[model samples]
Target: MDKQAALHHFKEHHFTPLLESELDKLEAKFHRCQAGLISDFKQSFRDLCAYILSMQQQGLKEPIGYIHYSFLRTQMLEQSYLYMVEAYSAEWYEDDSDCKLTYDASWAYAPMSAMLENLEQQRKIYMGAINSADVERLILESAPFFHSFVDSLVRLAIAESVQSPEYQAIHKAERLLIRTGEYRDISENLYVWDQEPLRADEVFEQLMQSSEEEPYVYENLKSLSLPHLHQFQKDLRYNDFSYSDLRGSQFHTCILLGTRWQQANVEGGSFQGCLLSDTDFRYCHLKGVNFSEASGRVDRENGLRTPGLCGIRFEHANLDEADFTNVHSFEHAYFEGASMQGTRVPRIYQQHWKLSDSQRESIVWTE
Candidate 1:
């Protein structure tokens, strides 16, 4: 469905009604306990706990559900702190000569404290999953949920007191909404690298034209399909090309120090005679790539050598005919694929230092 239709469906059917109901119940309880009496406060705390538990059970089934639930829980916990602060007033704490007397303090503080801690922990868990998740997937699947979540918060904040602790919760909710909105924007206009609006040759020319002291660095080029890029041999150090498609590209004798190629598609790319020290190739498709004579280790001015293959990963790629001879730390590189047939590889001793069984079997020994 379209964005508006999907958002309307989610808001009307799932996110809006649920959040409004929970917030309404919490607000009603807060209003009833305005006098700050311990009994009334305890009841409100119990109500909050019930809502939290209910959301945990029902609103964490999917990625969108978890994101919505986290946003709401954080807001709820922030509001709950208002009751705790009110409970800790002079009436609750009595200072005697020998000790301080506490009255119904645990009833007002304990549950909310526990719930806040749980809320933070759950938020972390959800955020970790969200970070690892595909941005496009999240935008397509969770955008409606995020939209309704932010809308619910905005509606709730209409009558909320700014000086009150509940306002802090609203502020936090707004920050989260803004972050999600930014993600949505990115998803809406994700660059099509295959379109080649930003060509490697053009970029190289631009870099050559610039007089910056540091080597040119490009970042956030995810999902760019820049195929068949040739003549990339330049000072392209410290560049981030993660999650881009560079299929069948050529990088003959390139200096790729500290470059990040994580999750990039470098299928059939050539990197022959390249300087690849400190380059990250984790989760990349390096099928048939030429790395022969590539210097994975570099001599530094501090009389020490940079690690040769500290973080190279070829976990699940077609390595047929990919050259690895004279590539330092070939032994340290991960190669968890099928056995090499006619591929040129480092010697058995060079491959033995840290090679796994599958990696050992995957290499064809050359002298």
Candidate 2:
């Protein structure tokens, strides 16, 4: 069409509102699409970059371990673009009414979708290139886009494997084992300084000092692991002890949810009256611990699953009225005076239990 005819059409159709509306629609689509893919994508990327640079600055001479790199890579490909476009498209169509406007909107979004998908591909390639040195340079150079990718990948890695043993171990060892960044003892909760071990007496003193109004301690307990604490204890109130020490330390009536005790020592630690639901004790020693009074007192606000007392030598451990609905026990696990109502014991033991006087007295073989 000629300019005059187009101008005439514009006048006839009141194109100003339509143009503004289209522009608004396009801008809104871009924002939504971007937002769906990332929250403050640029800022998150910068943070990721800073994290990487900080790691590199630490001058880590040891070779890094191989991670499931493809997991993060595939996640980026799927999340960084695909579902975002589809989600945003549905959102846009839900509001769009006019056919012409809808057509225009579709066109506008089409280019963006294609562009974003390509951008997502590029992100995959870039992040796939991310290794020890490349990750270091991307972080050091402060590449905003790279930062975005790195940030997403880091988060993705955390999200995907947060519950796995490797992730837990890495997290527990993040600070102490991290080759990046200089060690800073800003908070007693994050670092386990060999030079500044919290002595048993000091721990008791700290626990008893209720009147001094102890200062708030913000420790990055992300890497704080205590897989073998023969007798580690600290005041457990509003303190982030996600990976704190619990090795032979007796935790009494303390609230410890979301605390990281992965592979930490809890051997002989009396957890009487302590709230310890959902706290990781994987691969940790729990032999002969006094959990008789501590079984049912777990903090349930965090929605963690009931923990298994299996592998932890509960020899003569009083578990009266304790909920062992899913706890696995070996044949030798003693249950003298232990409640078996709804407590799952091995099937083989179930037959052997029939021969016992208690089973004979408890069971009535009536036709």
Candidate 3:
């Protein structure tokens, strides 16, 4: 097909429209997740406290003042109505704070997990049955908020006498709580609110970082929605950029090796002089982009090896003026549709290439 005909076909058949549609759905779910998640956490914390207090009433020392969700999955988190909790494990360890407790994926709650799953659907799962969302990193950054919430709740339970349903406020104006209303023993999860309501929007912002500033050193930027982001010579290697909407973003000489760009919209972006060895770009948009001097391959010398691109698929992508002279994988890279026009690849690729007649006609050999 001619260039115009092929481009028209690609535009009509591209799957980007489906991905963009999902963004709206995810945003709505995110708002729901924030408020509901916090409330559920408060209830879980209060339930744990009541369980400890019951043991103390029976002349047994409270094992631990922990709202440990992983442990509670066998107890209050077990879909109980009266805080009749049990234990997942008979052990507790020291938390990040002075509290003798443990921590798992705080986002392991049902609402937050659904939000994360839909956000990065193609993520690979290694540790568990489910694909782990940048959960570890999210928990790390929001450590202050979690620790404060835990410590304050523990202090309230320890100081106050667990006798009846009525809560005696130390400071009425500063106390923030959510009551279970099911049991008098399980009254509330207390915290010093400082007269401010929980900022749900602020919590959600951690996942969808804005383009105004650079990301953290180890931040997981998978399924990002920031567009027109501008940067220079950044080290963003070994990150997941799959399903990202980074269209028109500029990266002058950035290191993006082993980065995933599957189905990411990077149209009109600039990646001049970038190191993209072992980078996956199959099914990504690259319409009218500048990628000059980008090394997709490297030479191994004195037994020192460097990562190189092996197979790439420009699946109906617009590869306008992309020069792959030094790209060793240029021979193995697949190109179809509009990507066929004027793509400059090494002459060596043509001599030793194993592509059939139809595939060979799509490529242009260069010195």
lDDT of 2 by residue, 153-227 (tens): 232223223343432332121122111111121112222212233444444444455322442232233324443
Worst 10 residues of 1 by lDDT: 61-70
* Residue 233, candidate 2: alpha-carbon lDDT: 31
Off by over 4 Å in 1: 1-214, 298-311, 329-331, 336-342, 348-353
The weakest ten consecutive residues by lDDT in model 2 span 81-90
| C-alpha lDDT score of every prediction, in listed order | 0.44, 0.32, 0.44
Give the best candidate by TM-score: 1
lDDT of 2 at 83: 14
Pairing residues by index, what is the TM-score of model 3? 0.37
The residue pairs in collision within model 1 are 193-225, 194-225
- Estimated TM-score per prediction? 0.41, 0.30, 0.37
Query: What value does the lDDT take at residue 129 in candidate 1?
Result: 38
Q: Distance from true position, residue 137, model 1, in Å?
A: 52
- The deviation in Å at residue 88 for candidate 1 is 33
Worst 10 residues of 3 by lDDT: 81-90
